[model samples]
Target: MIGFSDTSISKIAKRASVSAATIYIYHENNEDLLYKTYLKIKGKMSEKMFQGVDHTRTVYERFEAIIRNYVDFIQSFKDYFLFLEQIMNSPLPQKWC
Candidate 1:
């Protein structure tokens, strides 16, 4: 029941019947939680992409399979993609820019 709102932490706490401080006990901050979520989503995407990739396949076939998997992953996680797009487009964090 994770949500993608600015108040995601608050919503999560409410849904889980816990105080926001309880979440902070596990996560340092909202940014850390977001990073963890991103890592989890990326891991799942990678696992699905590599699920049945054949090492013996032709280079072109393997490349196409990877590309298709990537495209599907992005398509399936459109909200996350949009969040990334917003971050990339924003003028925050000079390192990222």
Candidate 2:
């Protein structure tokens, strides 16, 4: 429900059966919405990376599981994964970089 394409606020409002003002009430601006969406995606990625771990496992096994989980998470959310890759590769604000 969160991932919207390159559409205007009015279009999104109509699709969601809400007013533009309602959307504004929830998000200060389009950038705010995008940031929130990114946070949601990042949280999901973090959760997936920590999906399975047992204290009894060997250290090597735990490391391998973590790597596999990260790969699986990236595969599951490829768009968000690509977005992250772009951010990391781009020259941006010092705070962001």
Itemize residue pairs with steric clashes in candidate 2.
none
Model 2: per-residue Cα lDDT over 1-97, one tens digit each: 2333455688778989999999999898765665676677778888888787666899989888889999998888888898766544544323343
CA lDDT scores, all candidates in order: 0.70, 0.74
The model with the greatest lDDT is: 2
Query: Where does model 2 exceed 4 Å of error?
Result: 1-18, 90-97
lDDT, model 2: 0.74
Report the lDDT tens digits of candidate 1 across residue range 1-97. 2234465677879979999999999898766776666566667778767767788999999988888877787898887666555544544334322
Candidate 1, 7: how far from true, in Å?
A: 3.7
Model 2 Cα shift for residue 12 (angstroms):
5.2
